[model samples]
Target chain A: MKVMTLNFLTCAVKNCKSSNDSFPLHPKEAELAKDDIEINPQLLINVLPRIDWAALRTTSTELGFPTLPEQPPSPEDLQSDEALLKELHELLMETQMMEGKLVCGHCGHEYAVKNGVANFLLPSHLV
Target chain B: MLPTPDTSHVPYNRVYEPAEDSFLLLDTLSSPSETAFLSSRFCSTSPSSPSPPNFGAPLVLEVGPGSGVVIAFLTAHASTIFGTPHVLTTAIDVSPFACAATNLTVRKAVSEAEAEAEAENPSTSGQWTSAIQGDLVSPLRPGSVDVLVFNPPYVPTPGLPAPPPAPLQELRDKTTFEEDSHLLELTYAGGKDGMETTDRLIDALPGVLSERGVAYILLCAQNKPEDVKGRIRSMGTGTGEGEGWKAETVGTSGKQAGWEKLQIVRVWR
Candidate 1:
């Protein structure tokens, strides 16, 4: 999965919603790959408002990506600054969660990523 | 227009290359009207009409996008037809090689479209393409999908005999399942009249489809399309009489592959 979709993913366990760490699932020992995708600034700007910069920054840091500012860049800055747009593009589009696990902070559920696909199938009791 | 992304890049030895069934699915989705409808549906607060007459990019997710041809074609062209900034295109496959090939195919298609657009108008933007490896749509959130597409392993293979007793030899490390044996099994092994794998995906539709979402599924005549439709119509939120998901045989293709008759069915709420 791309880092972009990880932004929208939260722990989907039935009773796990009340937990604090439910919002941003933690990526542990994630092996990352970068595909050759062209950076589209306009598309990046379009999704900027919806992205949680802090969650992305934290996850990227854990996966050994370059540091992203805790605060998201302003819309004006995104349009004008090519460097910022390029950086965001690399983080969102190119980086792939190849292998490892995404641990749910709330319930401590481990979602394994083997061969770039995250297995989110919870056991029967959890569902 | 540039040629379609070369399927030769796909590791055919491990991945299932696009075939006649894939083309049948592609041919069925010729019109972009559903996407326009989806765009309107996204902006529509009321079921009748769009609120602000705006276009909201549709989220298109495909299950088992083996070669990623259909997803790439749709993603690269959605922007031009919808006149939207981006379309969230995702392809999920069980095989890791398929996922990698999908990412590569999407990237190549996008770059070609971008180059062409740039030559015409330098300010053109691109769309987003994501690939995930998983069983069906289990990883995706519930009721968020706009368009769900699937071309599952529909070939009915004979049930293999049970394994023989284990030999009394030294226990070696667990063998690599990725050594092409299991991969081939997944590509076309659909147990029990080819409905076993497809049925699992059907069970997931209600949870993954949005209130106004639609699904485009490739079905073999062997799976019994009527039964599948009836099953879906009586699923979650599809309970009441005349108040369930509607199924239509949007497209059909005649191809001789054992007892399978290829048909693309579009199911909508």
Candidate 2:
């Protein structure tokens, strides 16, 4: 899973309804891989408003790519700053979570990412 | 253009390759009138303009994008023709193989589109596509999806096979590629009236769609299109529901003489 996708995914437990820390599932024991895909700067700028800047920064730092600034660039700055856009692109698209555990902040449930696919399935009891 | 995968690859053998129903879905979405409607819906200006300002591209999710043909086709065209700022496309399927295949297919389509755009204008950017493994829309947020699409397993099965085992344990057991291929066969195993899965998504539509969101679902004769439309039109009120959903038969395909007819039902509130 790419960091951009992880940003939108929340814990899937049926009972975990509060939109609190359920999102930006903390990646534990993450193994990263460079996908070598071309970066799309305009796409990055478009999604900037929807992303949670703080959560992304925390996750990126944990994954050993601390490229995001403490404060997200303004929309205008994001478009104009080529370096910043490239960094965000590298973090969001190129870096892949090959193997890891995404632990939900609210329920403490772990969603495993194996072979580059994050299985967001919950147990029947939880469902 | 309706995207068709070069299915000579090994991984594609495990996926439910596109068929008549798939083409019908494509025809519905790409028809001149529908294309015009979508161009207007997704783009505020013509495609030649530079970075169409803040045209917040709608979030499009496709359920059971078996080979990702339809989603990728939509992404390629939607981004290219509308000059959309982004095509935030997501594809979901219960089978792991389907998810992988979808991601691959979408990546190829988006890359090709981006390459063409770059050749035309040296400074063009691109789009993003993600294929997820989940049942229905369970993993997605409610009332957030803007363009929901589903080409469900509408071919009726004898009965609903037991839902797959826990994902992690099942993943652990799928040590062989052949074992994984077996699951792909269930892509068309829709239980009872072939509406089992389709019906559930219809029931969930009111909660799944954004206020102005729209859904395009492919239904066949086996699914009882008329009755399904009635059910959708009466799915209660509030939130995603706005004066009840308006259903229209956007397009249909297959022999009129037989029961092979497929219809694309466009639902909006």
Measured against the native two-chain assembly using Cα atoms, what DockQ does each of the candidate structures obtain, in the order listed?
Answer: 0.28, 0.43
How would you encode candidate 1's per-residue C-alpha lDDT over B1-269 as one tens digit per residue? 32455666876666788888888766666445654654455534344653343223456788888778878876776554335646677877766567778878887777777777876664333355467655577665566576788887787778522211122011122334444556666777777888788888887787777666789988888888888888877675643444577787777788566566788888887
Residue B101's lDDT within candidate 1 is 81
Which candidate tops lDDT?
2
CAPRI grade of model 2: acceptable
- Give the per-residue lDDT digits (tens) of candidate 2, residues B1-269: 54454434425445687889888877777788776766677666455875565535567788888788888777766644334646577777776667777777777766666666775653232345467677788776666577888898888778875555664233342445655545664677789999998988988788778776789999989889999999888777665534877888898887574666889999988
Q: Which candidate should be chosen as best, given DockQ against the real structure?
A: 2
Q: Give the 10-residue window scoring lowest on summed lDDT in candidate 1 chain A.
A: A115-124
Tens digits of per-residue lDDT for model 1 on A1-127?
7777787566657566556587578888888888777676756765675466788888777777778876888767988888878878888878888778888888899877766666554555676
RMSD of 2: 3.5
The TM-score, computed over Cα atoms with residue i paired to residue i, of candidate 2 is: 0.85
